[model samples]
Target: MSTNLNQRLFNAADSLRSKMDASEYKNYLLGLVFYKYLSDQLLQTVVEQAGELLKEYNSLEKQEKLYRDFLEDESTKADLIQTLKDVINYDIEPDYLFHHLAKQAKQGTFQLNDLHKGFIYLTTNFEQFEGLFDDIDLTSRKLGQDDQQRNITITEVIKQLDEIDVLSHDGDVVGDAYEYLISEFASSAGKKAGEFYTPKMVSKMMARIVTLGEEDRKIFSVYDAAMGSGSLMLNVKDYIKDTRNIKYHGQELNTTTYNLARMNLILHGVDNENMNLNNGDTLNKDWPTDEPYLFDSVLMNPPYSAKWSSDDSFMEDSRFMRYGRLAPKSKADFAFLLHGFYHLKDTGTMAIVLPHGILFRGGAEGAIRQKLLEDGSIYAVIGMPSNLFFGTSIPTTVVILKKNRTDRDVLFIDASNDFEKERNQNKLTEKHLDKIIEAYTDRDFKDKYSYLASFDEIKENDFNLNIPRYVDTFEEEEPVDMAQVGAEIKEIREEQKQLQKELYDTISELTYSKEDEDWIKGALEVFKYED
Candidate 1:
């Protein structure tokens, strides 16, 4: 059912693929899908709560008609709206419900203004959903050149979506389907995908590392300073025993992506009270300065090699002051790392994805790497294959950090060659991910694949964390047999001579003139035996 759901949702929105860019079209598709989910969920919740009141027409097939009938009663209408507000913290009018709108669309009576008003009502009255639909511009010419054309386009989408019964599925089917759509959009968005998506395989690996031993904890807190779509932090939820107790904290620099993260978390069943998401620059400003600033697990996949202000005033900030030097303006890789690390609890684990340059690049980044090694905060460096991400093809590494670690060695796993190539991108299959997780958790040496480098070994190389320096993945070429090679060459030469003689005899018989015969013999002479 979920498989078909994913396909239906994608196909429904794919009708507009030729009309606009994926990056732009995603806003409309995801926004409308979320609206349908909310409306359907609300209707189901109300039906369940007002069981006796709705018992007469409670059949699933008649749900929309029954809802309309129930809301028509003036006495029950106000009560229903009030009850919904008290229960779900918001209410949508019967006329604006997804079922009503979809019905109108099917009957060719849907208006773009009606949907716009619905969105405005939710964004204005619902604090949780405020600004959520800001990216979905109903008035944009991209939808169509004229309002009627736009209505026709949107109405067609609504009719297609009406085929899926969101209320039919149980237990995260809606959320899982939503995630599938996001991933599909990311694939279509190409380089723009970096703004709001992280490849699921990489997110899974980081989640496993950070939640290694703390699965049984009563309460676990996670943070991603440069959280993109909040998928990285949500992956941690899958590993925890009680996902409800896992508090999510994230800050995204992109406003659209910030809203995307919020919708993603909520769609995945995260409670509003459990999320601490903010839209702002993580590097220039420090957040979560209030109580419980630190987290038990800090995971990040910030934009690689991005520019930052690197202002002198930040030197006095607590997050950067300890490092003694700022991450350069051209590359804020270490800047994001330090921010996440500063918010990591002493007993917590931090995992971050960065470019390979952070391993050995000199200047401020080098100095910071040396200090981290000296303090034993660096735990493991796992090099990943190139083209694993959506946009970039450069090989990247995941550096795991921990506070107050007893181990003085860094585990280096050369997973650069571990991925399976798919189309234009390299993918880390489940088998490959499992292998990396095993190496990271066990911290044991595997020849040519992973190496446990001691503090002294690192010092010998001037604190360079390059994977090749530690894990020797070079396989010796197979030894060549010179005697066999020479014999084969002789055999090839004899065969060539036989063919040449055969060709010379055949050409001699076909020759009609002395000049032709000489030319043919000369051409054949070039293929004669040579030492």
Candidate 2:
């Protein structure tokens, strides 16, 4: 039954993709998925409420009448209405729920104007819950060249999503499906994929590392500068059971991706009020001005080698003011690092993925690296293998920074050689992530895997924090076998002489036709006559 349902859902999505691009199809699919989630939640809430009323009237003679009266009570009615409002306020409208949309679609009366109105209704209803549907562009060209085609595509999507019982089934499956769609869209989007998504394994590793040893206590807050699809911030929730204590904060540069981040958070059951997503260039424009704020845990997998403004005006900005020199416009790796570092609380720990260039790049980046190390903020640097991301094949590294540390040494894990290649991409499996995290947690310096470099040693290298300089992952070649090599060379020379004689004989046979029996003699006579 599940297989049949899965096939039907996929087929519907495939048909929609035939009419629209993945980027456009994503809005329809994910928007409907969000719609289904709210509908199921609302239906479930109603059923639960109805069930409680029935239970109360089980022994009453006029049970039906009593139950009806119970539902009509002002307080009960208000509660039900409030519940519907709460769910709708989170991007689902009572009238435009999946079931309702499906019913309308079935009758063939659903029009593009209706769907647009439904979207507007949802946004208007949830205006208090900002950023919920900010990423879903209903009118984007990716959906269709015109409104009619988009409406048809979306109607089909609504019909398909109406079949899923998201609220009744296991929550993880629905969340996983949403995540799967996000990943699929990211892969198709190519370089743009990096704007909104991080591989699940990477997010898991970062979440695990940051939440280590604090399984019992709740993380106070979590933030990501490049939230993308909010996957990294959402991932931290998977590591712990109680997320009520952890508040999520993120800022995204892309409008579409920022909307995705908001949807992703809510799709995973995060309350709209708990997660804050701002759309703007995080480096230049710092949103959410509530300051003196600090997070207990932070994780980021920012774009690699992205260009940013390094104009003299930015020197006066608070994020770069302390650093003295702004990160060069060509490389904003350190700029993100500084932003994350500045936002980190005294007890918070941050792990960010950066291009390997940031480790040894010169000029302003180099100065920033030196100052960070000197301040004892860097904790560990883990080298990830190349081709780990979808767009680029360049190897990357994770720099773990901390506001407080007991040790002055930086732990370097040369995980560049540790991944298992799957198809064209390299993956860090659960076991691999576990091993790396275990080494980090234990602070054990295993040969080839990790190394603990002292502060003085790092200073000797002029504060260059490149992983290879500290983690010695280079393997030594076997000692040379001179006698064996020499014997092999002598035998090769003798074989060469025999091969040369055989070649001469073959050449002479081929060249000597019936008329030219001695080609060498004929050639010599011709040369003498010419002289």
Candidate 3:
């Protein structure tokens, strides 16, 4: 069933591929999908609750009675909507439901103003629905230069999505299909894709690392400073031993992607009560909170080398104060790292994906690196292959951090060679992921693959934690056999000489005109095989 929806949704999305950029069309598709889900949820809720009240009547008549009774009294209608608001956090009238709109569209009776009114109703009353539909502008000429064409195009898209049954109880098909669409959009979105989606494979490995050996405690909290469509936070839940209850806290800068993240959590069945996803700058003005060092695990894949305000004022900030110097203004890599680190619990684990420059850069970044290493907060660094990301081909590294860590040795993993090359990007297969994770878990010292560098050894290199410096992945050239190669060359020359002599003899016996035979013999003589 999931496979069917995945194919259908992707095909539906392609209908608008030529009209607009994928990054733009993605919002329209995802927003409408969310609307359909919420509408179906409301329909199912009303039917179940109303059916119980009319259980005394027969089946067909009971259905009619349920609808009539709910609508007959204005007070009952208000009470029911209030009850729905309490349960689902929002209310959707039957007339404004997706089915109602989709049916009208199919019958050629749908009005663009009708769709506009439904969106207005939701956005006006629910803060969560704000700006989510801004990208799907009915008045945008991109949909069509004329209002009629725009209506037809949008109507067809809605009718297509209305075929999928999002109300089924068969697993999390809705979330899985949404992920498929997001992945497709990311593939075509180029550099902008990284801002909204981290490849699932990378997120899964980081999730496993953070939740590796933890027991099923009563409460577990996960944070991604740059949440990116909530893929990373949702993925961490998959690796936990017991996820009866988990809290997701994240801040994202982009508004459209932020809305996508919220929708993703809701469709994955995460209640609004359990999540605190924010749409704001994580670095400039972090969501204010009194609880620092409260998260059990922190994960981040912020834009590499993004610029930030580097005033000396940040020196007083709790996240950057301990690092001695702020991360360079031009490169906020360490700033994001430190922010997540500060919010981490003493027993928490943190993993971040950053460019390789953070390992050996000089000046301000270097000083911060030295201080972190000396504090023994650095746990392990795994070097990954180049071109693993969507847009960039530069190799990246995953640096894991642990607070109050007992070990003073830094584990260096050279997994840069362990990847399968796809068309445009390198990918970590399950086998590759397993090998890297095993090495990380055991802290094994495999020759040329991993090394445990003592704190003193790292200090000797001025606190440089480059993979090649600690774990030499370079292989020595095999000793060459000069005599063997010389003998083979000699044998080949002798064989060529014999073959040339045979050709000369054969040509001497051939019939030809006198001038042609002379030219043939001359040509044969010039083909001498030098020994």
Which candidate has the highest lDDT of all?
1
Report the C-alpha lDDT of model 1 over 95-204, residue by residue, as the tens digit: 88887898899899999899889999998998888899999888888778999988988988888777666656643443355456545665656654544566778989
As for candidate 1, its clashing pairs are: none
Per-model TM-score, in order, reads 0.88, 0.79, 0.83
Clash count list over all predictions: 0, 2, 0
Ordered list by lDDT, greatest first: 1, 3, 2
User: What ranking emerges by TM-score with the best candidate at the front?
Assistant: 1, 3, 2
lDDT of 2 by residue, 1-531 (tens): 344335545766775666656665665566666656655655555545556553454322233333345457877766666765655454334455556667778788776666556666666766543445544566766667898766776677676766665654543433355445544454554545544566678778889888876667754678998988787878787767787767899998877667767766766777766777678888887655685357878798888888988789877877778777889989888888888887888887899998899889888988888878877889999998897776678898988999767667899888888788876677889888888898898776798888899999999998888887887777899999999999999999778767666655555556445666676666544433210
Which segments of candidate 1 are over 4 A away from where they belong?
1-15, 50-61, 74-83, 86-88, 164-188, 487-531
- What's the true lDDT of residue 453 in model 2? 91
Error of 1 at 295 (Å): 0.8
Residue 346 error, candidate 3, Å: 1.7
TM-score of 3: 0.83
Q: Identify the runs in model 3 with alpha carbons over 4 angstroms from their true place.
A: 1-3, 46-83, 165-188, 241-244, 476-531
For 398-490, candidate 3 gives per-residue lDDT tens digits of 999998877779999998999898755678899988998999988979989999999989989999988899998788999999999999999
Q: lDDT values of the candidates?
A: 0.83, 0.72, 0.80
